[model samples]
Structure formats: structure tokens, C-alpha cells
Target: MSSSFPFPIKPVPFMYLGDNDRNLPDLSDDEFCDLVAVLKALARSSYPRLEAVPLALNAYNCNQGTDDDGERPWAYFYPITMIPPARLDEKNDLLPNYPEIELDFEVCQDLKRRWRSIRYGGDDNNNNQSMEFSPPARYRFLCFIHKHRIDRKNTLQKGVHTISIWDREWDELIWHDTYHVDRISRRKDIREFWRHVKAPGFIDEVDSREHFMSRIRYRTVYHICEQIEETLRGPVPPRHTIYAVMSTALFHMNNARDLQVSIVPDRLELFGGQHKGLLPRFFAHLLCLCLDVRPGWSRARQKRFVLQFRILERLQWMRLRTREYLELHDSDRDGEYRVDAKKKDGGGRQWMYEALNIP
Candidate 1:
């Protein structure tokens, strides 16, 4: 648990996984060096693993070909450490008798606090059963809490704790989240691969980079945890909380101005569990599957009613976000999604938008 101040640093490999030998927008040698330095920072910070710790970043249209085209977006990664749950006595600071757990803080503060409180009888309020239990079953308890939490529904808010980088980019900050699980990769498992795009096989050096970016996608952290649970013996977990953000964000971020960006108040919420209520379920339902990429999509409509809860009229976040969205269009849906199904399914739906805490 003890680490030196400033976390005295070490450089890591940043194998550039793209094609740079072809026609790019053109960059002066000086600009290239600065850009490479920025990229180096990205590599150093954002290392990916084939396991739960893999950091998959969307480095697309990142440099705008070269320098001659326009202002280039910069790259950097956020390194994270995941902590294991707190210990049995709760007060006994062994923290599950493991070495320091390293994961995104923002995404999972609940584990220990919930554990500590349950073990110590702190929270007077009642939700799940009182936390009294033995220490040896920490992982089982973890599985229990995760399973029960998701089966319960919109009761728990905030989100899984995460350490993320909010780098400023062209009137907005484009970013990614990393959950470094501190495990090594076998690399051979395509299914184990995270934040990485795999092609049928290798390509010409020039085209390899393009093919790689095209394959970038997201997976639920639970998917990662599920894999972990499977690695253990005895009972496999019933289900893990992938949380809406993971599945929805590819479970990653993309721009709609071409699929992404922001936040605000006036009492608002957005996506997944936003004020949309039934709409959130609607999205959750779609996202829960839609992954098969099979012809069975035609059967999709048969289950349409699965998500058909009546809309909660004028949901708070819906109204607030809608207003903010109009303000961005200077007021308009851009008639984008209306004409094209793919566009509508993707970028067009986010027709209007803005960041709250908007400047």
C-alpha cells in the first residue's frame, strides 16, 4: 500500500499499432516530433492488456492525416490501479489480505466501503441484508453484491469508479477509460483481447493501421470480471453488472458530429439511466443483444415489446438535455438520421447536443 511520492515514473512500450508510411495530411518534421511526443505520452500512460486491464483507446482520425489538413487531435492514456475489497474486520486494514488492488477509483469505491460498512454495521439504513459474514468469501460476496445490484434495477446511482483523462480537444474533450487489472497477457486469445481491433490476418504495413482502428470496440467490465470468475473453481457467478455505460459507450465513446460529447444541470440526466425512464430500458434492451451481428436481427422486432414501457412524459433529463441539444444546433435535428437508417441508428439520433458546465 505504500508507494513513493509522485509515483516516480518508468517508461513503457508504446508499439504504434497503425500505418504511418502512407499518404497523410502532411506534417513538418518539427510538428511530427511534437505529435510523436504527445503520442509517446499516450503510450506510456495507456498500456493495454489481453485481460481486464487492457486499455483500448479509439485512435481514429486522430491526427487528421498529417499537419496540412487541420488542427490535430492529441493522444494520451490514463493509467489506473484497481484495489481489492476491504478486509473482514473491516477495521483490520488487511484489505482482503491481498496486495494493493489497482483499478479505477471512480468506478468502484463501493466494494470496500460497502464491505466495511456491512461488516461494521455503519449504515443504519437498510437495503440488502445486513453485511455480517466471514472474510474468506470476499470473492463470493463480490459476486453476490454485483449480481443482486443489477437484478434490483435503478436503485444504485453514480457509477463504477474510474480514473480517466479529460484532455481538451477542439471545443470538447475526447477521452477513454482504463481499468488496469495488473495482469499479464497470453495475447493468443482473440476473445481475451481488449480495446484492440483484430483483422482476418496481417495486412500491408500501410493498411494495417486503418484496419486496426476499424476494429476498436468496448466490453463490459463485468465481462472482464466474468472471465475472472470463470477462472476460479466451484460455483460460477449467475450474472455480473456490465453497467449501462460499458455496453453503451461500444461500450466506448465516438463522436456524432461525425458519434459523441457533455453534461449539465437544470436537474438533468442522460443515457442508460437518464430521465428517459422507459427509453433507458429501450436502449438497454437493444444493447443487451444487438451484438450477435447475425441475421436473427430480423427476429429482433418480435421482441420489440420487451422494451415498450410507456414513455415518462417530459422526463427531467430528457427536457434539460433536449433544450441543451437545441442550443447546440443553434436549434435543429439536421435532417441527418431521418434519411439514412445507419446514420439514424448512429450519429443522427444525437442530432442536437452541448456540454453542460457548458462554457
Candidate 2:
């Protein structure tokens, strides 16, 4: 060991260098020194004012363990060890993936104001309705299945049950000719029924948040029915049947049980008083990076990969090497640094040492 370097040079762990159980070849003394030389160069370039230790490049220090300076020694010595090059490309979802949607200026402003009010440290107990605006007609329609507790898949598909529920709830609609029908013909019958009938006046009025939400649902169901009729080359579907299908689509889109009916139109350009139209796309990119494919890698490996990315992204690119190199000499050594070659906890795990055959 030299006086300039604080820690003594240590050998690579058997799992990474030995050719025994895992069929990995052992590194010769000369090869080990060469690897240390490369790491030394990296550390020196990273921290021009700080000295580096040969022991920092050892297998035990190869993971996220920090030196006395409270800095990760290996991170500065070999940046790629933290995150492989293949995974770096997906770290950013740039401006291209998300495009701005055009919207009414007044509605867009309203949406923007609402999104802004709840950004940082707001009361969680606050009513969501106050923070959220009344959704458009189309978005409102999705809520119908929820409010009425309709069985979209079964009850709505079978028009008889759906109409019975609607007739019971509204009473004024006066649904007739329902003595022994199990299913109403989806095409001609629905269209003919709508031709002579209309929803009650209260259905269209938005006196309260409930009314507002209901109105949206009704409008959206009507839109879906119209689309079905035009595309199916027949008649509009009864609101009940279409509600079932809409609910199913909503479930798939949200991919959750909470069933979020509120839709933030993409056209809104500001949020929390900041330009936010493309903010979601940026987060989407980050999510992709964190959830990148690791094929057979364990959860621990995936977590370390994400942690390295978060740390690296925040630091200055030019000083990266310096910060890592200084940790080698700036930190104190407690004992002979060693790595448990067979540890399965995933912490301080090396990539080359991974079981490649794991399925």
C-alpha cells in the first residue's frame, strides 16, 4: 500500500473472478492490477484535488457503500457499474412522445387553475370536487354505471333489467311493453324508443356537483349510442347496455379498481402555475426507465438500478469521477474489506456474478 492511497489494494471477489463453481475464470495478478489502474485513472480524473485508494475498487466497495466523506466510492470510480449503458437510453421521455391537445380557452384556464391548487402540500382531507371541475359530457357518461350501481357486463347487455332499473329510478320515463322480455333487440328497438322519448328535464340540469356529473354521464351514453348506431348500421343502444361497455373500457384504461372518472384534458397547458402540458410525458419516461426490462434479474437488482439512475441524474456530469475518487482516500477503513461471494440478498450484488441461466 502507498501513502498517497489511504486503503490497501484488495483482490476481486471469487464470484466475479474465480473459475470454480460458477464457471467464471479467475483474474491473474497482472489482470487485477490492470483493472485497478483503470479505476485509479477514473477516480483521479473525477476528483482532481482529492487522493484515491486502491481498496475502493475492491468487490466489497463495488456496490453503494459510501466512504468517510459520505460519498459513494465506486460510483465515482466506475460510473457505468451503477447503471449499464443499455438502460440509460430509456431514462428520458422527451418532448416528442406527448403532443398538446387543442381546447376551449375558458375551459383550459379553469382546468389549469384547478390542477394548480393541489400541487404541493395541500390538505388531503379537502374535497376532490372542489379541486376538480365538472367533466365534459363524454367523461360524465362513464360515471353512470358507477352512480346507478349498474352491472355493465350483464344487466346493461340485457336491456330488460337495465330499463327496469332506469324506470324505477326516474319513474317519469314510463317504460312500457316489458311483461316477459329478457333481452331487448339492440338495434331497431333502441332507436325506435329514442325516436319518441327523451330523458327528463332534471337529467340535463346541473344545479349541484351530482347533477353536473350525471348530466355528463347521460350525454356520453347518448354519444356512445349514436356512434354504435352509425358504425353498426342500425339504431342507438339503450343507455344501460352502452353503460356496461363504457365501464369496461374505463376499467381497462385506468387499469385499477378505483375507477377514476375525471379526465384532465391534454389541452390544458398550465398546472400549479407552471407549464405542464408535457410534464406527464416526462414522468412516463422516468417510469419506463425505472420499470425497464431485467428479464431474469431479481427485485433487488431492479431497485439498485433505479437508485443509481436517480443519484447520477442529479449530480453534475463533469464532477462525477472526482466525487467517487475522493471517497476512496477521504474515508476511514474499519477492517479488511470483504464480499460474501454467495450472498443472495441482492445488496452489493455484481452484474457479471449474476446467474445467467436463471429462468
Candidate 3:
């Protein structure tokens, strides 16, 4: 169906989820200000619902604390719209009565060209069935807070002060506080709450920003591990190769040093799927070796592995080493070689190291 709104109804320029360079398209200060103004004005009258389009931005407070310290600002977008999917009949054909079908901005260009070809019978592509049944594209206006820039005074500026549309899919995973959802239900004005931090009703909800960073970092690590798994499917990678892959991936991320020292036991719990928490299959088996635990042990038994050695191996994986681990050194016993067991198992095998408390 056609929109009742007048001419300027078009999707804004957008960025796909997981884009590294998430800055808004370069625009002059005046243009940027005007865009925000128009969006706000439109929300006030033309689209009242847009005023409630809540957005949670992970704000990194660079001046006060480490990169991991951040606040989730209760922000909202003033201008955002979605065009609904086409009405399809029982046979999966567009309804004859509905003539005007608005194409989604995300898939419009490619779909338009392909639809043209199909209508004219100009192409006989075998992939048409897949394309026809593909899920509808749903785009939404989203924003990313720019990394703080150092001002002339050498202090980090409050970045992303104004909203400029950098679009994303509606279902994209965002940094949000679920608490606000309940607050909004109670009719709390979140925008005002964040704005007036010193207000009597204001609550201190700011939390360690590492969780958000961890999400991103974990995705990066998982994908890297996935690629490594796919490439070296059969043979177990040597310790050095395994170490190289893990170290390089961690080194590139924020708080690399700290992360390498230990991946919280809870974080290990996060890794799971068809491999049954033993993602990449081989990596899990090798993890036992790194921590001096038995290989091919079930996940329950694996959970009891020593945290310290795993962290050391994980750290080694994140860094570049010119030399192999020294077999004679005392530290080598911590990772490169197994430590002498203080006791023996019921089966008469030497017991592995005792599980250390997670820091």
C-alpha cells in the first residue's frame, strides 16, 4: 500500500551490522545539525511514535576510566520508518488487488533488477526459487556513538552528541539494558533520566562496559576459530599454530593482555552449538592438553580443568613468540609439560593438577 506521507519518504543511507567503521557519512556541521533537527521535528508531529524509538548506545567514557568502563545512554531516534512486506496469496503470488508494492530499501536495488529480468523472461537463472522464497528485508534507522576524540584541551569529547542516521536491520543485536524496558513500561522518561544524572529519581545503572566489548570480541574470536576449524578439519594443529591463531586474534582486540590472562569460566560456558560446547571440536580436545587435563573428556569433566594454565595457553596464543616454550624452565611445567601429580586416581593413573579458583 502507498504511504500517506508526502515526498521525502525514502530510506536513509545505512550500514550493515558488524561494520567496523561505524561513523556517519561525512557531513558538514550545519548539514548534520539540520538532519537531526528535521528528524526531531518530524517525530514531534509527523510521526509521534518515532519519539519513542529507543536506542541504547554503549558510551565509552574515555576520560574517567579504562576502555571497558562505559555507560548505556538512554537515547532514541526521531526519524525511522519501515515499509511492510507485500501481501502474498495462498500460491505465494502477490495479491492482484494490491497494485502498489513498496520495495524495501535494503533489497530494492537488486530485487528491482532481478524482477525486471524475470518479468521480461530475459533470464533463466536456477536460483530464482531461492530468491523468491527469501525472507523479506526489514531495515531500520540506527546510530553508533563515535569513538571519543581528543579535544584541544587534551580531554576526550562527548562523542555522538547529535543523531545522524546510520541504518541497520531491525533485529540487529545492540547494546541495551533490559532494565529500561521495564522502566519504560512504568512510563519513565529515560531520555530525561540520562540527561539529568543528578536528578533525585536518577538511578546509577552504568555498568562495566566489558560485556559489550566481550560480545564483539567473542564474535571475532568465534569466527576466527571457525575459519581455523574449517581449514584444518582433520589434523590437530601443533601447539605453536594453535597458540599463533589465538594470540593474533586476541592481540588485535582491546584489553588483549587482560583477556589472554583468563577467559572467565562463565565465558567458556558461552561457547556451544552442534559441537556441544566443544566448538571447533579439535580446540576443546586441545584445551585439555593446554591445561594438563585428559583429552576427550566430557564437558562436565572439562569444566574442572585448572583455570591458570588455560589462561596461560590462551595468552600464549594471543602473542608472538620467537622461541618455543622452554622445557627446562619452571614456567614450562605450567603449560608446555604436565606437572607431577600429588595423588593418583582410583584407576592408578597419576591425578592431574587441582582446579584453581577463578579470579
Candidate 4:
């Protein structure tokens, strides 16, 4: 006989079941078919009654939390087709269809070992109950994407798309005592139970106004001031972004900062009522600095400055429109008046041309 044994050691097929499998060089048609057959067999053997429908094969890079060796794990996306476990309904009719099962798999060497060693569907200690596979990180990500898409589509169909604010703290406060209350006690003290409860410690009247102010004032100068300083360090300051500026200003006001005067309850209501809280005050301060307006200016002068600003804004918009029209005319001979018989010509275009004194 030959010096070598009849069978040589080979890498476990399950370990290579990922996107990297596509990069495997020059396989004949038979070899490719054989590989797929092996994968199908492995999938079927792993989970009885489950059919593996391959979608995509790719290597998944695991983050620091998931990866042990920093090696990119081979990954595959497949829909595991299966019927729902039989359940008896009131009418004794089985639900015909269930939701599709999609899974992202990371092909790992350890997984192959675990797969082989673990005995499934038996009284043995190594049965499926005792041994289970930890889901890949991408599995959660995929689930989130599916859920988000469904929610977004449903929300869009309803026509009102807006960010929803959830006051978790307030919600917790409402339910915290109510959840533990005995039924009889709750029924007896229903009104007083909800109404007599004290507000949150931070906003409670137990603390003197001066004490509250002092506490919030120090917090603002320390925490908020440091954050603002850090944000202003980069070449493009965070304040340049409108959202960032608004958020920073809001944070300061929320923490009861003395921007000019103490942000008392009465002052808060006054500023917040018609102007939607501290935004107008913050905006006014910003505008003053930008326009180099003095703090001592009279209300009449301030109104005049605002009027002038509005006029300047209108002029700027007109100039922009004229420039855009000239550029479009130079680039295209037909400009906005391209011949399309199906399209209706409106008076808006004629009005624009007349207003801009364009032929």
C-alpha cells in the first residue's frame, strides 16, 4: 500500500459556510453542487423540519464585544422555512401561514465542534435543551431593521410623521406606587393616592428657592460650561449647527441658569407663554451679538432693527432668484419654457418674469 492513509484530515465544512465560500477558487459544477448539498444536509440535520433557503453569503466583522480573536467571522443570511408548532384553537383550525423566519449565521470553528458534540432531541444530558447556540450580533440588528421598517411604513401610511416624546420618568412616577397598591386600598384612596403624592425631589417645594437656584447654578457652570467648551474646541464649532445651539441653550435654561436674571417660575411663564419658552431669549441674545446691537438700546430702535433685517432678507431672496434665472437661461436656451403640450402653462411663471423685469 502507499505510505499515506486512505483518508486525509480536512477542515470542517460548517466552518467555511460563509461569504468567503464565494472566493473559493475554481470549483467545478459538481463540486459547487456538492458543497450546497452538504450545507443543506447540515442545516436540516441541525434543526428538524427546517428548510434552509440561502439568501446571501458574506463574512461578518464582529465588534470588540463579540469577537474573541479579532478575526472576521464568515456569515450567511438564510430564511429558515418551517411550519409553526401545532397548537389547538377554539375552532380547532390551524393557522395556515406564520411569519417568515430569517436568520444571520456566523460560521465558526467552535460552532462546528458544539454542533457535533451536542446530542439533540433525546433524554441525554447534551440534548438541545442543555446546549444552545448564542445568536450572532447581526441577528439583533436584522430584527431591529425589520421592526423599524414595518413601524416606519405603517406610520407613513397614517400621514402624520413626527418624532414622539416619551416622558419615562413621569410615567414611572405615575405607575410606581399604583402597581403595588392593594385593590381595596386603591379603590378607597384612588383620588388622594394620585393627587397627594409629592413632586420629584429636584422640583419639590421642600427646598427653598435660593437653595434650588444655588444647586442648579453650580451644575450649569460646571457640567454645561465644560461641555460647551469641549464642543467649541473643534475647527467647526458645534454652535454652527442650529440643533446643537438650540439644545445647548435649552440645557442651560432647563438647569435654571442666570443668563441675565434668575429664571423664576413667573419669568419662565412670561418668556415661555407666547414665545415657546427660552428660545426667543437665546435667539435675541445671539442676534444682538451678530448685529453688534447695544444692550441699552430702546424698544423702538430694536423694532426698527428687526424691520430692517426683514427688508434685507427679502432683497437677498430676490437677488438669489434673479441669479438662478440668469444662470438657467444661459445654460439652456428654452430655460423653464420647454415645449411639452401635455403640461399646462401657469400665471406664476409670467408673474415671476414681470417682477424680475426679464424678457
Candidate 5:
């Protein structure tokens, strides 16, 4: 289905006060409270039907200790619930579909010295209290965009047009590039870098390297075409999947002597980072492409299509094996009198010529 939400999702800004040396903005308690209030008001204005606007604050310690003292809640925001509009006559108002916003607070004791140095001689609270307010190491704000399945049949669309939050001074907050979740290309690059660095010995063993290279020769081309087809149709595949397919395609294309595909490391580097089940997903995409099938196709249709191609490919390989066996037997008997037919047919025996035509 086509996306109901607009392409290129905009980034939402979150205040950060991590590095004192860099002169980052300090989000004071009053300022933070003002920001939260503004965000809540904005959400209500845009989506009036919201029943309860829940916001969560999580704290992370850079230097984690074994003690549970670090896990205590450093700060809290009052719970805000909106009154549900009462229905009049027979008409009912539509409910708000806004996603919950979560703010993460990275608390580092190491940065406290730097923070104190930046705000030297600041007023300190001497009130009688058992606990003291720990200085914030860093602040990150996160807002989620709910994945909505747009139905062309429905006349009314749900969700906000712009994903944004305003600061107290009425200035529109802007997100840094680091906070952009929709940066698929950037994410891919990070993934690839981690993968290569972590798996330096992935192709070290001779037998494994040979096996991987041999399988990729037939599998890579088919996978690339499959990915292209998916991309052409609506609902683009996941970034990770696309990266894996493209990476395999490039690797095989570079190694394959007959194929005219070229290498672009800049592009391939996107698929190389830390991710769950990355290796399996990589191999799975390769296998699916090799079989010329996709996830959404009917099981029966996929079986028929893939099995037919597999049978044909195996038969062709078997034919080459039989021809080789016959030639070997003939050579054994001829004893230096055999014709140069095997040498002449070497060009025609190339497996890619037949395999490439399957998909």
C-alpha cells in the first residue's frame, strides 16, 4: 500500500547539555518544565481527542556501577490527562491518534565537574533534604510516528501533518542531524562499519571464503533483481534488507569475471553495522534471490516458480558433469590421440550463461 504519511519524515529537536567544553545550551528545571508544557499544549491543539498524553523520562549512567543507588529516579513530570469530549446528539467526535513522546536523560557524574566549571558560582540549594539533585549529563527527546495503513476508501485522515515542538521563547525547536531517525542511509553506514570491524575474520578461512564466493556467483544477480522489483512496487523494503541485497550484489559482481557489475564501496558500507540476526538475514536474502522468490508471493506459486528453475539449473549442471565424465573416459582410452573437443567447448560450459537467464 502507498504511504499515507509524507515522505522524508522531519526530525524533532531535543535539548542536549552534554559537553561543557563545547558550550551547549543548559536546560534548567524551569526551562524544561516550560518546554514540556509547550509540547503538551501543542499536542492538545493539534489532536484534541487525546484522552491521556503520557510522557516517560529514562535515565542512563555512562559509568554504570554495581550498586542500585544510580537507578533512582532523578526527576519527574506531573501526569497530564485530557478530558474526553462528550458526544452531542448522534454525532461522535474522532479520537486523537498522536504517538507518545519519550525523553531520555543521560546522567554522567564525570560531566558534573565540567558543568560546574561552566556555571561557576551558581546558587546552590541548602534546603534540608536527604538527596541532592544530580546535574544532567545530557538530554535527548524522542517522538514516535505511528505507522498508519492508509485506506484510500476512508475520507478522513488521522495524525499530525508536522512533527514539531516549540520552546518557551516561542522559537521553533530544530533537531540536529544526529537525532534524525529517518536517516536510513546514515544508519546503514553505521551498521556496515560495525559489521566489518567486528567480523574482520569473516572471510579468513580458505574453505569458507571459497564457499561464500562460489554461492554468491549465482545468487547475487537474482537478489538484486528481486530487490529492484520490491522497490518499484509500493512499500519499500526495510533499510537493512536493501543494504544486504545491495552488498551481496556488489561483492559477487566484483568477483565474477564474466559479469559486468562494478564495485562502489561507499554504497556497500551502509549495510555493515551491529544489528539483530544480521548474518542470517544476509544469507536469507541471498537464498531467496537465488531461488527467484519474495515474501509476499503465494507459497504454492513460489514453490512452482522456484522449483522449476532449480530443476532446470540442476539438469544443466548434470549435463556438464556427464559430458566431462564421458570426455575423461574417452581420454583414458585414447592415450594422447584424443581430439581437443573439451578445450573447444570450455567457453560454452560457463554456468553463468545459463543461470543468468533463469531470472
Candidate 6:
């Protein structure tokens, strides 16, 4: 690690040089030392290419498994790893993740702040929630990648800038993680500030923090939705588990349930409802529910998914007045509301006779 770096100390890189690269045969002791010599020279100075950090992080650390090795997202020195395996590039929804990186972000201060700034984070806690964040809309992005080994799958490509994995090994890096990161950065202030020009804080200061952070949170949801649409290379994204994404986004932020809703738009376009605008931010609520998605959300996402099958299903479960409203309606005829227009052969229109007989 060099002392003359731009930011902090070079994060420690977890060392595990073994048979990570399959195509290239295992390095001979001499070759290994040569490679190490080259890397040690590079690490002796500053390499602040922030643009390429995440890719490196993804390749070296991000993945789901034991955190013993710093290979987790937080502890990578050099970014390039062996090329990802071939089964990774299957789809955009499944962002190949290095669980270590993902977990690392969860705890790092700066990275945590950055991640918290995303729409997914705004729905995590009620204490940190505000009156300005918009309820996230429901979306459906595919999850086509999930590998047995995510670490080795992050590297092994030619280009250092864009995703540069081999054609055959493209499927090895889960596209979902990459897609989301790319999509979110598109809405950032320094990089993609223009995308948020019409968002909550685009105008005057709504509240104290001038609503700056809140608006950032608001734009995140939009970014997520739009990105899925674009990155999935589609006219529309696939049907995700509905509330699953919404809840996940909110879980990241630590926001309140109802308070965040105050800021969230109430609907989303699921499949054919893109133009109708009847899509309620049930997706937003899903986020509120996902903070503890383990067992708590056991039924929530499923319930939201089922509601789309029938409108009445939702109104009944979430609304208290549905049963009362239903009881007042006429069941004998095809009509679905309170009985008042029934006119018999005897002439006059009739109301519920039970109420009249109340005397």
C-alpha cells in the first residue's frame, strides 16, 4: 500500500492465488512470483481509477459465502480477477454479485452512505424516513444469473473500463448487480445529475436538509425502474416477484412505512397498465415490508403478486371497509353495490325492506 494516494489507504486485498483461472493453467512458482512482483510494483503507488472500482470489487470480493477472506467486496487490491465463468451473462435482472462486496457496503461508512442514498435504502427504517421520499413503483426485472462461485467470475476480461469479459464467459458475471449499479449511477448528482432535474428537490427546498438527500432518494426509485427497462434491453422488464424489488429498495434506506409513503407516488404500471396509471405503489409498500424480508415478508410479496390476479383481492385485504361495503350490496342481481333500484311488477322502487321493518 502507498502513502501518496488520493483517498484513504489502499484497502487490503485478500490473497488467494490458486487455480482461479482455469483456461490459463495454474501458475508455476516462478510465474506466480513474477505476477506478484508486477502487482507489488503497482500497489506501491496510487491507482485512483474510481470509475473502475466497482468492477474490481465485484470480481474480487462480491459474492455470497464465508466472510473469513477479505475477498468480500471491501478488501480487494487489484480489480482484475480471472474471467467470470460462462453461465453468468444469461440476463440483466440477475446482477452477478460478489457477496463479500455487497456485505462490505452494508457496513462501510462512505460506501454505506452512497448505498443508503439509493432508493432501496430509503425504505429500511422508520426513524430515518422522511415526508419527501416517493413510494417506489413495482417492477419486474429478470434474475437470469446466480453462480456457485461469484468471485472468479468478476474478472478475467480485456477491457478495464466497461464490462470486458469473454463472450463465452459473459454469463459468469451476474448481470443484475452490474445492471443496477450502472442504472443507479446514471441518476447521480456528479455524474447523472440531469436525470433528477424534475425530481423532488429540483425546485425550492421543501424541508430542512433542503430535501437534498430525500430527493436523491426519490430519484433512485425512478432510476431503478427506468434502468431495468433499458438495461434489460427490452420494451419491458420481465415479471419480477412484484413487491420483492420494491421492498428490497426500501430495505436499503431504513425508512418508515407510512411516512415514506407520504413521499412515494401511489401507483405503478405492471404489464398493460403502463398508460392507465392505476399501478399503486404497492411496490413501495413492499419495500417497507422487505427490511426484514427473511421471515417477515414470507407472505407479503406473494400477497402483492396475487392481488394483480383480481382487483377485489387487494381492496379486501388492506381495506377495513370492504366487508361492510360488500354486505350492503345486492347479491341476488348482477349489480355490485347497495340495493336501491329494484322495481317489481307492483311498481315503486324498493330499498332494503329489513331496514324499513326495523320499526
Q: Give me candidate 4's TM-score against the actual structure.
A: 0.17
Error of 5 at 169 (Å): 16
The C-alpha RMSD of each candidate to the native structure, in angstroms, is 22.4, 26.8, 25.2, 27.6, 26.2, 27.1
Leading candidate by TM-score: 1
lDDT of 3 by residue, 232-319 (tens): 6632221112122222222212222231222322222222111222212222222222322223455445444333222232323211
> Positional deviation of 244 in candidate 6, in angstroms?
7.5
TM-score of each candidate structure, all chains considered together: 0.22, 0.18, 0.16, 0.17, 0.19, 0.18
The lDDT of model 6 is 0.25
lDDT of 6 by residue, 1-359 (tens): 11243332122222233322111122245433333332222222222233233322222221122223211112222232222222224452433222221222212222212111123433332233442233221111111111112222333322211121101111111111222233333222112221122322212212333333333222223334445657666423222312222222222212212223223332333211221111122211221112112233334443442233222322332222222222333323332112333434212212212211110
**Residue 231 of candidate 2: its Cα lDDT?**
75
Could you give candidate 4's per-residue lDDT for residues 1-359 as a string of tens digits? Answer: 11142422121122222332112222334433433432332222221111211221111111111123222222232232222223436874644344433222232222221222112221222234434532211111110000000112212221110011111111111110111112233222322222222224212322453433233211111133234446765222211222221222233233321222222232222211113333322222222222221335554554444332221223333234333332332122232321222224531233333333323
Tens digit of lDDT per residue, candidate 1, span 43-115? Answer: 2222112122222221122212223422222222323323233233545333322223233332232222222
Task: Assess each prediction's global lDDT (C-alpha) against the native.
Answer: 0.25, 0.25, 0.24, 0.25, 0.25, 0.25
| TM-score, cand. 5 vs. native | 0.19
Backbone clash count, each prediction separately: 28, 10, 2, 3, 5, 48
Clashing pairs in 4: 19-57, 19-58, 272-277
The CA lDDT at 236 in model 6 is: 32
* Cand. 4 Cα-lDDT: 0.25
Give the TM-score (vs. native) of candidate 1: 0.22
Q: 1 or 5: which has the higher TM-score?
A: 1
Report how far off residue 128 is in candidate 3 (Å): 30
Runs of candidate 1 exceeding 4 Å displacement: 1-13, 17-53, 58-81, 86-359
What is candidate 5's lDDT per residue for 160-275, written digit by digit as tens? 11111111111112111111123343233222222222211122211253343332211111233234446675332232232333233323222222112223122213233112
Model 6 error, position 133 (Å): 27
